[model samples]
Target chain A: MSSTPSLWRRPFLPARILRWPSGKATPASAVYEHPLIVRYCHWLNTIALFILAGSGLQIFMAFPSFGPKIPQHDLLHVPPKLALGGWLGGALQWHITFAWIYIATGLIYVIYQFASGNYRQFLFTSSDIKGVWPMARFYFFRGEKPPAAESYNALQKLAYTFVVLLGILSVWTGLVLYKPVQFSGLAWLLGGFHLARVWHFAVLWLFVLFVIGHLIMVILHGWNNFVSMITGWKRNPDYLP
Target chain B: MVEPTNNEKLAHHLARRDLLRLSPLLLAGALFIPSVRSKFITGGLGVGDWLSEAIFRRNHLAPTFSTSELTPFDQFPLNTYDVNDPDVDFDDWALTVSGDVARPGKYSLAQIKALPLQRQNTKHICVEGWDVVGRFGGARVSDFLNLVGANTSAKFLYVECADDYYESLDMPSALQPQSLLCYEMYDQPLTREHGAPLRFSLPTKLGYKSAKYLTTLRVTDVIPQKGYWEDQGYSQDGGI
Candidate 1:
């Protein structure tokens, strides 16, 4: 091995001790958590998703939806002031520019997950399935402590995996819409161009909901979650062993 | 000799340098904000349009279909200022060629029809997420241009429609094999609903670029005018 010290061996912050009446103690300190690749991917995804959402809203406003052809009376309109790109051409420009970036970053994230065997952290086992209720109870405040979680809890793994799948769906649906004739097979498989457009719009809303949930969880988890994402480190005062 | 542990070094490296590098990127990203968005940044769209044109090529043939697949002519949307402009008399209706052309006069409907006929059953894609395959028959724009002795050296063609609509085509797009000056649809003469007498058919462009009810075709070296919708912020190139 090279002379440079391994990344995991970095010194952690001193543990904060919480003494219990029954002589129990817990030590919390900043501990290395996210990898550099993970942090980069996370931030990249965040930027791309936000841009995509806004620009997508702009494009959606142009046609609005599939309905009875009644001239300009389409339902579900988003005002231009609230949307990015301002105009259809501008929106198209933004959407296409960032689409490539979004796709490449997501691909890199997947490659890193498989190549580094980090996919295991997001894979829930039978035991994890069994622990769901207990974990839920802990979050619901019925239990004193949460069940053991290494990298992610079962619920988190499920949500993350679902979001990743949604990302794939978004890209696929977008492709079908972008070049319906060129990828006619994919468009046909998705039940036609109109249906593909619907799926693409639906997935965008799903991403919006996912972002709201993610932010709420980050707030609930407090500074540790935020700091770990930024610095790839976490402090757990309740550390065991 | 032992140096600092890897995590400590990583922590220090991130705190001191990565944040510094990332700040610029983040600041640059803020330029995408709506209120602050600039052409300097949006210039990428023009770049993308240019790149797409280069890769896809103006001469690229759009997929054509058999006549059986043609969407009924009546189903095609009629989008114009005046569907039936009172000023346009069919008997007097002729496409006038001027500017850089050697033949600077009007060509009657019969003359345009007699030039050389090319037909295509191709998808007419609208920007508003709808498309219809229609069988359009007409003279190839290139053939018509050569017939009028248009300066093929010109950079743009300013197409003015009888309905007061206007659009300019890049020289290459104007010369595309699929580009046509169409007068017939579904094996019959076009109705007023479609561009009758004649309309520019650029299957390579979105539906809007096909100026309908042709009044004038001016060959020019520069883009002297913008299309009605182009002025309203539609893409000038109008490629897919």
Candidate 2:
């Protein structure tokens, strides 16, 4: 432990407890679950993703149909309150601007995770598949709480991995929509220009669903788990011994 | 071991340091300020335009469709900011060519028609997100530019329509093989609602960037005013 950098030292070792000073004598059971880079990227990406989604809705209002323009059949009306920018032009400004920020933070986070080998903490794999059912049962069906063996549970890893893949898909679809002629090959792979638009729109809704579930889990996990994302430390985490 | 004074204090300090590291994120919040908001919006659009311009390949052609994929002529939406018909006198109308051109005079429709006709089945994409494939036939803008001896190095090709709609195109886009000074659609002469005598059919650009009812064509470096929608906050490049 003395040979390792404090930030990266035995990150999952719950037994390596920290003892308080004599004045405040207590064993603090805390874990540095999130690195500083992870926390920063998480919050920044949150803001950018929100703006992108809101502005996207406003842009969608310009043409609300997936079919031909002549016999246009609108799918649904996105309420003005739910949209960010005032109009199509305004929305595009927001959408295009934050798209860069979103991409930048996402790239940095992904690169950092891979380079530092921190992805092992959350990246889902075949080994996690069996643990998922138990966690899901505990959360949804009143089954026994699975003992915490790692920083993130199997279900959490699955969700995180799924969202990352979704993020990549959204960016690809968005690029095709932005420049169908320039990225014609990508558009073709996504089933042409019209279908690319459909896919981009679908990705946005899937992101919304993920966010909703994420928020519910955060609340259920209580303040300690939520603070870990902000402060890079989880105090009294259940996973800590 | 040296005894730390207070564990709660140490924890608070650690959290504060971590929180402060994210101060750079505050820059995004500057968008909330009313005075700064517009500037950010313009800056964002400018960056987007810069990126669009960088990636645009002059040689690249917008996808061409088979005639079977063509949208029915009646179903093609006729979108106009002002009036569908500006009621131009076709007999008196001529394309006034000016700026950085050897021939700075009105060229008659017959003179333009003398050039070889090229026809294409291309998609027209609107900024509003609808697209339609249409058959357009015309003389390529490159050929017309050659006829007038235009300075090919000029930065922009600006045009004004009889309907008071104005648009500007980057020179590269103007010289694309698929770009045309169109006079016909669906293999027939254009209707009054469709900019009859002359219009632009640029497959590489957004619909609004291809202004209808062409009247004046200028090859210039400076654009006093950009296109109508662009002036109203739409993207200036307007390339797909």
Candidate 3:
């Protein structure tokens, strides 16, 4: 409601606040929306996530079933092209290796978001609930585009918040599967080893779905939005005054 | 409003400079280069091994299932890299013990079984992701190590199987109370397919680490041959 930006909302780097020859602000100026650390973590985590998913598929090919080993009933076959490592051992190496990268990037991102209080940009809250239906209508039913008052809309905030939580769940479930005995208490909380495997697999599919939706939105939003993530600036964001 | 040309140029320069700041991330692309790919993969795997080993608790036990939860004996899986039944001379079969031990000699199954027997219903988890809970009975490996006067401080316990399958265990894992020189399963003598005579039953490690058809057991610090699957790129410290 205030014209002045909050301390957390201010760009880490100075924004290009341009003025006309008459000293009036112009829309041609650029705002630094993403911090350097945020962009770094984003690209690195993206690469790690893809590698994890591909190698995970290869690992699943080892036992493709949630049933008993003796009477093994394969649930589904993941195509070799969709998989990363050539074999089980090879897949395990990739999975374990990238798991560290994935965890590191995720941890850094979450810590930075909280420490800088930048989480407000995408954290969904009760205030966001009223904006959701309007954004959904505009996106899905060609309704009038809602006025952009902030960096992210309600729907975008909801999706980002959901995916971040999903990322945390993925890591927890993965640990349970990797060392069920060592994390026996956690495994028990998730309904034992067998159920934990199921939950991990389910989390993978949800991640795949989220990635698909995210890609579609990125393509629709075009280069301006995409460039903001890479170069940390948006030339004419709708939210800019 | 039309921006001045100099202002536009400044924005362009700032964006380019910001993009260049992320050039260090381009190093990640080195993973695509064939020459260095294996090194990265192995290095990553090594980190994973180091972390797992660091957190391993020697006394912390793997979970045990109730009798009713045990996987039926008939349904228990027979997993082997080679022949399911590696023909061994049962009459002459004795675990040859060597390396850092006061009594480095052949130990008969009778000698191992003579010690206090332990029965447990523990889970057997495979690297391939399948798992089963089965009842296993054996003498505590620690008891045998004590009887043989083994240097418990040794870093590794290496074993070679009749099937040519070899495995090594970290001394801490080797000394777990649940670690056993297993000779029985499902309250019956181990079948030929299940590494009869002598084998390892370590609930804390993956299935492959519990090598079947035991022929030689050595207490040592150096492992010339890590394990059958390990040499093929599996983690050496395959702790569960």
TM-score of each: 0.75, 0.91, 0.92
- Residue B155 of candidate 2: its Cα lDDT? 93
Error of 2 at A106 (Å): 1.2
Best-matching candidate per DockQ = 3
Pairs of residues clashing in candidate 2: none
lDDT per residue as tens, model 2, A1-241: 4677555443533323444444544456677778878888888889889999999999999999999999999999998999988999889988988888888889999998877768878789899999999999999999999999888899999999999999999999998888888888999899888999899999999999999999999998999999989877788777655
What's the CA error at residue A198 for candidate 3, in Å? 0.9
DockQ of the candidate models in sequence:
0.25, 0.60, 0.62
lDDT per residue as tens, model 1, B1-240? 789999989999878777764753674577757555555334655654575466556545777888677776666666675666435689878888889989899899888898888888987777766667888889999988898998998878998887788888887888888888998888788777677878887777788899888898889987666788777666667775
Instruction: Report the alpha-carbon TM-score of model 3 versus the true structure.
Output: 0.92
User: Where is model 1 chain A poorest over a 10-residue stretch in terms of lDDT?
Assistant: A11-20
Model 2 segments more than 4 A misplaced = A1-26, B1-25
Better of 2 and 3 by TM-score: 3
On residues A1-241, what C-alpha lDDT tens digit does candidate 1 reach at each position?
7875444343332323333344346343455556777777777777768878888888888778675233445769886676877777777767766777678779998887766656666656576777677667777766756645365777777778889899999989987776555456677799866688789989988998998888877796788778888877776623433
DockQ winner, 2 or 3: 3
Q: Docking quality tier of candidate 3?
A: medium
